[model samples]
Target: MSKPVYLGKLTLFWCSSCKVPVLDGKCACGQKTEKMTITPPGDIRPAFPYDVNRINEVSRKQFGADMIRPDEIVLYNKAPYEDRMEEIICGGVILGTIRFETEKTEWVLMPRIEGARRICNTKTFTPEKMKSGELKNLIVLNDDAVPYVAEGTSVLVPGIYDVSDNISAEDEVIIITKKGEVVAAGRAKMSSEEMRNEPRGKAAKLRWKGTPADETSPEYRDDAESGFFSAPRTWDDVIAANRNILDTFERRSIDFIRNTAGNMDKRVTCSYSGGKDSLVTLCLTNKALDDFDILFSDTGLEFDETLENVRKVAEIYGKPFRTTSAGNAFWEGWEINGPPSVDNRWCNKMCKLTPITALIEDNYAENGCLTFIGQRKYESLARAKSERVWRSQAVPNQIGAAPIQDWTALHVWLYIFREKLPYNPLYEKGFDRIGCWLCPAASLADFMNLRITHPAYMAGLDEKLRPYAEDKGNPEEWIRYGFWRFGKLPPFMQHIAEAKGIITGNPAADAPAEKTGE
Candidate 1:
């Protein structure tokens, strides 16, 4: 499994007077604020294509139709040192998040109020809103049931006061007290009528309970602050704010490169992956050394945008681009070894490492090259603990060093923006990392977006997995859920499949045949 990317705890404060997220206890417009936590149904996943459509669909299905406005801008925010999780901000508040879970699935977790707004909030199934089909999923509790229905406690059927007419089992719901306070958010265990009439059984499973933050008391409005929601407007402003830090990083990286290369007798090269990190590395290497070549491993699975970007960067820098082809190696390996999984990454060996090794040997075998790669500690635990310089056993006579190992993703973006560098266009299109187009390590959201932007690629992938799935007695859901990408289902996925009564086939039988030609 890939290393877990840490997501920092997110907190949002509401300025009731300004009706906007405020950066400090006092807003720019000068309004007192109170803390408010909007908890979503699941962990936040990465934003995918047609996000508005998906949000609308969930609203209409779970609450009511025509709830969220089309003009609401979705802002993706990342915390310091955290790259795996992205918070989804709308209307100056973090209403939801896209989180990459341990199972490698990205889920969008939206708060109850956010869900209500998306579905047209009716203020807890009010008689008037009921006629207009608002508050479609709600659980009303009697006065006596409020305290017992705390976070993590299941709501019982007996103390039910009233409920929305359209509620269904497993529907996301806001649980309200008899006095009209939205005390908790949960999933309904039974339909509306069942929850109202049943004498015994759980009615709803509470996800979060009301806290002091949720209290309507007037005295608690002076101690809250919103962080990034009220950040500066322009990219230049952001760069300017961090200019000192950027300069420090730039100086340190340049020195590291100079010192490392000055002691080595071998040729110097930058392992250009065409991603933001590699691009930044290339810039720093140029500043440190006058003569260095570019080594690009064309895995054949690279995005068309990335291939073009490699050429563009090489041309601008006037460096000799040494390309090593992995032509059809990924497909050939997949055919012989089954689809590559996090556990079995033969595809990387075959398509990336093998070709790059040969390229080094064929060109610079006389003297090994010192390669600068764009790797950051924030990327993973393995990379976090890695040395500034090291030699890999997989490749002979080559030393690797990372200059920007301590920088964050935010720092990289700031530098790139300040320099006005032409980055890969895919990042603007919502791709976080650019690598093999069909990399199994990719999140489900990536594949979902790929399906929209590149249907033929998804079709080709499904075509390859269908036969393998069918032979193993696995249902089409195995392929649909991207389970085929993993040799063994991780704990989270296994639990999910079990809950849904989906059976995953035995992995031993699905193992591929012997290796083919290298």
Candidate 2:
């Protein structure tokens, strides 16, 4: 976690002509692209309809409008944070970022002008010009305040701001000049009523400073001024935009598989995870070689949909299908090592590696199969720096190769959509990354969604977890806030737990519960 993960020399680009993101400088439409300044490790992903809706829902709550239109194609780059945060991209410019605050279980929008302008209008009420109630977070400052705020200074009360009726202390506000230019976006230190009545404190703590002159894109600036963003589009439009790039990338991946298969001294096999990445890898492997097996490791906790997808993929490819299961190992490990946490994933050794290692040793002996995994660099720092072809020191018998190591999530998804592959329905249902149902690495938002959609599974997990929290605090609060995921609570979590009287200190190290519940 200490080491920074960079996606290497590769940088992400936004294609204005195609209305989508492209991996290279030149877009499929033969138009030059704008380089996106995304935060590292820049493993950006296309925001799905579900993700889009959720973001818009958050924006609507704060700004009284949706920052991203459902019809617009948008991409999100993950940012460093305690919980979930993503930098939203649209119209070849940064719209803003939307993040989930773990303590509040709330989604907050940290807008740039591209996003703030969509929901805010800085007009005063005239017969021809009127301020909409929907533009409720606006703070208009006098002429004296504009230049100072433009310099990234916080809005001071002495500037004599005229604030919107809905402005409340701690509410996110869009600071604009009397002339209607957006100056900054910040959190309110004083409510609208307080700002009007009082005279000597910071009015708003500015988080993002904005000036039209600071932006390089004249077209984007024009669009912002005229409100020209968010035209109607579909997923098909996205695919069409990246069609040329996809075909070229596909050919390269196919060639990689062929070369890796041809050179391997042992048998070549494709590992299937029933995820979009693996699906593309399997398709490439099928095209690359005539003889190979599709291997799957069922870790007892896998969803039935995932299991079905595995079977369907193998059947479609007309390849040999082989699977091994660690049927009761996870449950047994739970009794010994406790539930798997982000820091300590004892579950991986038991459920995946042990079964796979055993299968590789028994079937292929010493010179193990050359397994092609659907590994992508953008997934993590380690994976980003990982070599395409290598052997894990832990499982030296097996040789692993990644054909799509450089692919972004968008690349994998577009490939899946173009090929009309039978992907897991869970993605459409809002599961972005497919894995075990109870993966601790997932945010609390994921589990809350599961509580409603998969009640039986959630209820089962809660039953096991509730008993452990009985002596700690309100069992319901502990579960509701996702206190069970951490073996050692991070500082932010520790702060929340202490405030809630959930526990006096880190509970995991304090005492070990006999049996456990990620």
State TM-scores per candidate.
0.75, 0.89
Candidate 2's TM-score reads: 0.89
Top candidate (TM-score): 2
Off by more than 4 A, model 2: 1-4, 122-133, 178-181, 212-226, 473-475, 504-518
What is the Cα-based lDDT of residue 176 in candidate 1? 68
lDDT of prediction 1 = 0.66
Model 1: lDDT of residue 435: 95
Give me the runs in candidate 1 sitting further than 4 Å from their true place: 1-108, 112-127, 140-154, 158-161, 176-181, 211-237, 492-518
Question: CA lDDT of 309 in candidate 2?
Answer: 86
Per-residue accuracy of model 2 over 344-398 as CA lDDT, tens digit each:
6667777877888887887788678899999998787688778999987766588
